[model samples]
Target: MEDILRQAVGVLRSMWRFRWWGLALTWVVGAAAAVVIYTMPDRYESTARVYVDTQSVLRPLMSGLAVQPNLDQQIAILSRTLITRPNVEKLINMADLNLEVTSGPQREQLVGELMSGLRIGGTGRDNLFTLAYRDGDPKRAQRVVQALMSLFVESGLVSKRQDTDTARRFIEEQIRNYEEKLTAAENRLKDFRLRNMALLDAGGRDYVGQLAAVSAQLEQARLELREAINSRDATQRQLQGEDPVLLPQMPNAAGVSIPEIDGRIDAMRKTLDALLQRYTESHPDVIGTRRVIEDLEAQKLKEIEMRREAGPGQFGSLNANPVYQQLKLVLSETEARIASLQARVGSHEARLAELRASAELLPKIDAELAQLNRDYDVHKRNYETLVQRRESANISVEMGATSGIAEFRVIDPPSLPLKPAAPNRALLMLAASVAAIGAGAALTFLISQLRPSFADGRSLREVTGLPVLGTVSLLGDPRREASERRGRYAFAGGVAGYAGAVAVVTAALKMLQG
Candidate 1:
């Protein structure tokens, strides 16, 4: 610590050796800096404060029914990115700052100046923003601030409209896509029904249920058919009571089955009669039906031959007895009904076989049907939601037009600055003086290092790395002492001159600031 203090004292002594040089340098630098500071143009700052109110009375009321925008976030982003190059150019135009710039470089320089001078500061939480611009002309600063405010307002409105338009277009496109999906789904369902029409029952049950129901129906139909056949046989048995008459004419094929050849023959004749009304006897259906009747007649004749071989008796007719005729009619009707029921049962059996064969295919069809239904429902639901949202968007936009979504209030109008806000002359002058003193000290220190002087024997010994054995004392001279005193007076006058110069420059700065 003692060595450090001694080193500092040595440096001060070195600086003191060139004290006049330092004082002269200080005066020159300080004067020059003061002049520059005084001549520097003043920058006036203009500012405008805008407060964004994101909270609206309608927001809570229309929460779910309307599409709400994030006003705070949008305003914050706008405030930050508003100072873009395009916006700067716009600002220049609005403020008439580009009228004088004829060259490309000048325009670029002006754009850069505008961007740099424009300052935006705000907090998203508060939703408050301050737009500021600095310029040499106070009126021009105010004009720039005004132009920025106008841009902010216009951008906000334009952005809101653009967002609304984009959302509407998206929703409309989705609705169109969903409509196509609905059409496709309907067509698919229609095609499925058409393809499976043969297998499907009137009841809208799955294929397994249809199979069970059809089996049950077939059993019931067969029971009825059997009952009808028995009734017809009983009627035939009653014909045996008709004086042993028409029994010889009928075929005893079995007790349960009476020969339905007569009833079939009657129905075919009726059909033939109907066909004759629509077409000539030469028609293929008439020829085929007539051929069937001839074959049946041959079978009847063969049955009679068998009956005659059993017993040699003449075939008798019971058409004379009215009771026998009535019984015969009943038997014929019953046979007809039994034949129709048999056809129904056969159809049912075939369907049941088809269902059993398609057991694996049934499940696949069912699953496919379920998937299609689910997809159709999903698309429908999404389409409905998008439609409702579109309505809500329209409502929101209308409400915004009526009540506004957000409010941009000018809390403070653009301020017209009257006084300069920059170029602190007093501070700059002080710094310049301090720097000049530092420069002089540096110059003297360098000279002292080059031509080193040892004030004491100890320093010389330290430099020499040797022990000092003795010291020499010089006698004082009156002329030399007087010369030393005069030199001290000259140094004091130089100091006074430095102080006076500093005081004069400071006075001038104060007057100019005023």
Candidate 2:
């Protein structure tokens, strides 16, 4: 450790023997660094902060249970939109940024530089954002910020107005279509009713009762007519030349009593009983029995003739022939009348069925058409209302700027900075100092490596590794030594250069302080 320390001290001492050169270089470098820093132009910076909070207009559409839009995403979108070419150009035009001297690649370079200076960033957890720009003038930065904010508001409102107009137009078109359909349906129903005229008034129990009564009267008339015709035919038959029936007497000892063969046999039996009681079988009374039987048989042939003469009242009760004949004639007429009435009833029933079927369907169709018409009207009204609002929106008065609470608010406007943010003077000077120290150390190392000759005995011995056999001393007088120091060119020049470097450093320090 001691040896290492001794070696380090010796090296430092050897290096410091050329300390004058290091001092001169330090002065020269420091002066140059100060001069460059002083000549550089001053730059100005402006910073603005904005808070982007949530607003209803920018909020996402949602149902009761739906998730809301992410505020961070919305802010990101707004930021990107603001940085677009149109927005940037608008701000440039509105603010009248002084870029007249800038042209071609230089102008483009300036714009790029400006873009780099303009910072847009937001905090992750907070809604606050920072916007900053650096320029030669501070007021231009403030104007740019104001213009951008105004343009953003205008663009958003315009988008909303367009959407509203589209919605109104779509609704109106749909309403018109529905109205046409409703009108057609109503017209069809009216036409159907007009064509089937009778169906409208034909209904209720009166029509049914009348139809039944007519049928009953007709039936009774048909029954009476039939009986009258039967009576008239029977009378005609009796008047014709037909053989008279003979009565069958009770069987005597000589003749068989065939009552079925003789229709008048009962009449003959009564006569025979009267005769047999007055005389014996051989008596003249028996001959009178045969005559009486024959007379009864002849009378039986005219019974239908007698029935015809009885007229409308001769028969007993309901069975009287004259009354029955009259009743039968009335009955036949009633039956014919009933046949006509029955046909009418059938016709009425068919018409009623047709009318009923038509009536049943008409109401259902009418009801459906009515509902359609109502819906069409409601939609039409809504469409008209929207159209009016949209038309109003197109006017300047309606599109006028509105001042309200906003999601994004500017906290600080941009302003120009007095000093250039680039090319830091302090850093440049520090670098220059470091470079001077390095050069000084490098020169010393080079001289050491070159093994330069020194007047000192130990160094001369160390370099050549040869013995110094003798030493020469006091060869010159005092006056000559003094003259040598004054006239020596190498020593005089090196000292002058060192003094000039020191004077330059002192002047630079004074200028920097001023």
Candidate 3:
């Protein structure tokens, strides 16, 4: 520590050797620096802090809850906009700043200086932003900050209003279109019901009763036809035996009883042909008529055979045969009656079946119409509900609006600075003093280096190779150096000239600054 102190003393002593020149220069340079600092225009800075609303910063939450704007995106947008040319120019105009550049280089330099003074920063870990601007006038800086705030707020409101209006109009159009589609669907269902009356199930009233009645009539007609056909077939079998009964009595008159048996057979064959012409083979009456015709044929053959066996004598008696005559008469009359009854019954059955089919079709049509009506009613009700809601929406649109997307609020106010933030007079003066002292030291060092004499007295002896002589002191006060002292006067004059020149230059700089 002592050695360090001793080194510090040695440096100070060397520095003090030029004290006279150093002190004079220090005052002159310091005064010049002061003048320059005071003459320069004072720069004023204004700053404002704003807290960005988290609502604008958060992302839109479309589903679960209400959405908030993304804060990070808003901050980024603000950052870029803060440096935009339009914003800067507007600030300049609004603040009434008078700035000029005499040349291209000057303009460029001024731009750099302006950019350096303008600052935008954010509060740590918060959604707060700070904006600052510096100008020659304090009021201009304050006004510039205020102008930016107003512009941002107005711009945001304008953008939000436009977007909300667009969305509202689009939703209205969609609602109207849905309403039209719903109405058309309802109308279609209504028309379909009107066309299919059976859809209502109204005409199916006697469906079961009518079906049963038609079935009963069919059964009864079938039973009657079967009985007639069976009776006819039984009679035919009995009459078709090998021989027919003969009539002997009225015989005296009919010993001629077989008299016209062949003629009678011819009459019966003609009656059978007439019956066949009136009815189909499968008809109940036709089956009975056919069976009767077969019986007549068989009985006529037997009589003819009997007549041939009894010879021509009993020919007339054949018709008088009791069984043969009785058979022929009954067969012809019954066949004729059966044919008429069958024709009448068949006609009634065909007409009844047609009526029954018509009844069945009516019920089906009614059922279909009923279903269509039900569907139409449902659609119409839904359409009416939607239409009412749409009307309400329209009225609401005209009355008031509920769009609330964007809003702004002030966060922090501008502050007035307590101290001047420009020029830095004290620091400038100190710097000038240091430079002046350094210049004095440098001038002394340069003079010492240029001199012809050696700094070490022993070096001169060694170069000349001579015996040492009495030592002479090169440094001393002029009055104290008795031997000639001629070099001392010259050295003093040179130092004086240098100091005088420094004083003149320092004074000129001061005058210029003032």
Whose lDDT is greatest here? 1
RMSD (CA, Å), candidate 1 to true, equals: 9.5
lDDT of 3 by residue, 179-239 (tens): 6765666676567556644322333334454456656766776676667667667667767
lDDT of 2 by residue, 174-203 (tens): 656656755665576467546644443333
Candidate 2: where is the Cα deviation over 4 Å?
1-14, 55-67, 77-91, 98-102, 144-406, 416-435, 446-514
How well does model 3 score by local distance difference test? 0.56
Weakest 10 consecutive residues, lDDT, candidate 1? 250-259
How do the residues 248-271 of candidate 1 rate in per-residue lDDT, one tens digit apiece? 443433321224456556765675
The regions of model 3 sitting more than 4 angstroms off are 1-19, 55-69, 97-114, 152-408, 415-419, 451-454, 457-514
**Per-candidate total of colliding backbone pairs:** 0, 31, 35
Q: lDDT score, residue 261, model 1?
A: 54
- Measured by TM-score, the strongest candidate is 1
**TM-scores of all candidate predictions against the true structure:** 0.67, 0.38, 0.38
**Per-residue error (Å), model 1, residue 238:** 22
Residue 55, candidate 2: alpha-carbon lDDT: 53
Of 1 and 2, which scores higher on lDDT? Answer: 1
Error of 2 at 290 (Å): 68
Candidate 1 TM-score versus the reference: 0.67
